[model samples]
Target: MTQIVILAAGMGSRLGRSLPKPLTELADGRTIMQQQFDNIRFAFGSNAQVTIVVGYKLEHIIEAFPEASFVYNEQYDQTNTSKSLMRALQASAPGGVLWMNGDVVFDPMALERAAALVAREQSFVSVNTAKVSDEEVKYTTTAEGYIKELSKAVVGGHGEAVGINYVSRDDKATLLRQLKRVGDQDYFERGIELAIEEDGLRFEPVDISDLYAVEIDFAEDLERANLFV
Candidate 1:
């Protein structure tokens, strides 16, 4: 079974809203997390385990997704995506896992490609080279196409990471181990960087540059994301 973990524990203070990021209504009238679930079901079918990590206003998410499994992150106020992701990863079933940021809205095709990669037992990070931004997490790959670095500071990098990735069954343990090295204040990608550099965890870049995707972190981002609808 392939598990899908969504990190949605953080309060969207940057968005300047009282609503939790995942529960924020998109232009389509559905919440961001609902769109994610719809896309995931389209790509991977209905059988895959979809687990969400919730904290701030967790009840809203529970109400929104009554049937979905959830892992509570009690330290959401004190931690970042890394900690929320660790909780989700720990709760995931034993097998390949697809990890996504709950506040992001991406084209179904992008997730379909990610699911295909995971079905092949490949661990990969989705990237969009078409649009690169300084504020978004970026990735740099070696000439051979293996990820070398992943961080927001990687200016002039190959592409922006789309906040979606897959960890094969064989690599799940290694990824969890690497995630343990990440600090509470850091993004989960930091653990991926460490895994790539220190443990040689192979996370190839899957270019989905042509696909439409947006991380709704701010008002401007929400405006741009509306274009997708």
Candidate 2:
């Protein structure tokens, strides 16, 4: 069975909305998380085990998706993606977990591209090399094209990580261990970077540049995302 996770624990304070960011509605009238659910079910089937990590205004998410499995992040305000992702990993079954940030608006094909890696049990980070912004999480690859440096702090970055990734069942333990070592505010990318640095974990960057992926950080981002919808 395929395992999928949606990290929806952050407060999304920047969006300036009363509801969770994932609950924000788009032009098509589908909430962000609803569209995400449709995309996941479209690509992975109705049988895929989907677990959502919810925190800020979690009741909104829980009430919206009653069929999904959920894990609460009590420290959601205090921690970051690393901790939210770690919780999902710890609660997941024995297999690769395909995960994404809750606020990313993208084509369903993005998930399918990541699904290819999951089916092969290979770890990967979905990336868009077309535009690498300084504020986004960027990456630099090794000689083998596996990820070398991944974070917002990288200097000469190759591309932006589009917030979708998978960790093979084989590498789950190592990545989880590394996540525990990162600071509370670090993104999950930091853990992946550490895994590559300390454990030699190989992560392929699947190019999704042809697709639309806008992570809604501000109102302008939401506007850009709605353009694709």
Candidate 3:
């Protein structure tokens, strides 16, 4: 069983919208959450357990995704993405977990490629090596191709980490423990970096450079996403 966790707790104030980011309507007329669900089902099958982490107008998410499991981050305003992700991970069952950010819209084939690696019992971070942007979460790889450093501060790195990753059941406990040790203000990637550094959690880099994926953080990103859709 592969559990899917979506972090949707942020207010997305950068988008200049009152509605929660996940509920924002895409150019296709489907909500961002709906598009994610559809893409997940298409790539991973309908039986995959989808758990959404909601806050900042959680009622809208609940009403929209009644069939899916949910974990509420009551302190959404006070915390960052790390807290919302931790809540979802704590609520997940024992299995491979596919974690994604709610504001991202990606090609389904990119997920399929990542899922295939997960099926091989390998945890990985999705990256688009074709282009690296300063605004995105950049990453650097070791000589052996393992993620050596992952952060926005990395300059001229291999590529930007698309906000999607897979953690195997075997590595879940270690990753969760690392996540718990981090401060609430940190991004979940901080925990992931710690897990790699301390616990020897090896995350292979899955390059989906040819695929289309966009993280809708600002108005321009939303415009790009609309063009992609």
Candidate 4:
């Protein structure tokens, strides 16, 4: 069974309100985090053991996904994703796992593509490439489709990361160790770069252009996520 980790432990201060970012509303009358959890639940079924890392307003998240295993990151406000994910990765124990950001909104097709790659035992990323406008998030790539760099900028002409990652058991272990090496200053993205450089873990970028993925950080993005519902 593939263990999926959803990192929802952040305090979204930039959202400019007290409500936890994940618990924010969508057009479908479900919270953003709830919608994502429901989608994942559908994709993986009971075999899909989900571990959600929560910190800010943790109780609300707990009540929302009672079936999911929970790991609280006490330092969620002080730390970055590298640390939170490192902690969640620890509690997850030994296994092949998929890491996803709690904030991204997308259709099940993206999850399907990720599952396909995992079924093949490959390390890959789901990305949006065809909509390579200036506003799109960036993911640098190699000729063979491996991501060489990733960010909102330097996004090559064709690919942008969709905030979903498939990891094998070995890769997961390696990533955890790298996470330990990352200082308190780093975020998850830094760990990804380190994994690629230090461990030769080339994340294969799987293009899913037709699918839309909205990452809600600010109020405007939250409003944008409404379109998906």
Clashing residue pairs for model 4 = none
The digit string of per-residue lDDT tens for model 2 on 1-229 reads 8899999999999999999999999999999888898889889887798899999999999999999999998999999999999999999989889999999989998888777788899999999999888899999999988999999998889989999899999999999999999999999999999999999999999999999988999999999999988
User: Model 4: how far is 172 from its true place, Å?
Assistant: 1.3
Q: Top model by lDDT, which number?
A: 2
- Residue 206 CA error for candidate 4 (Å)? 1.9
| TM-scores for the candidates | 0.96, 0.99, 0.97, 0.91
Candidate 3 Cα outliers beyond 4 Å, as residue runs? none
lDDT of each: 0.87, 0.93, 0.88, 0.79
> Which pairs clash inside model 1?
none
Name the lDDT of candidate 3. Answer: 0.88
Model 3 reaches what TM-score against the true structure? 0.97
Cα lDDT for residue 122, model 2? 94
What lDDT is obtained when candidate 2 is compared to the true structure? 0.93
Model 4 spans with C-alpha error above 4 angstroms: 131-137, 152-158
Identify the superior model by TM-score, candidate 3 or candidate 4.
3
Residues 1-229 of candidate 3: C-alpha lDDT, one tens digit per residue = 6789999988899888888988888899988888889889888897789999988999989999998998999999989888888888888887879999999988888878987887898889999998888877899887789887888888779899999998888998988898888898889888889999898888999998898888988888877888877
- lDDT digits (tens) for residues 108-160 of candidate 1: 99988887788799999999999778888999987788999999988678889
Higher-ranked by lDDT: 3 or 4? 3
Root-mean-square deviation of Cα positions for candidate 4 versus the true structure, in angstroms:
2.1
User: What tens-digit string does per-residue lDDT give for candidate 4 at 10-125?
Assistant: 88888876867888888889888788777787777667888998999999889888988998889888888889889888888676778888888778778877788888778777
TM-score between model 2 and native = 0.99
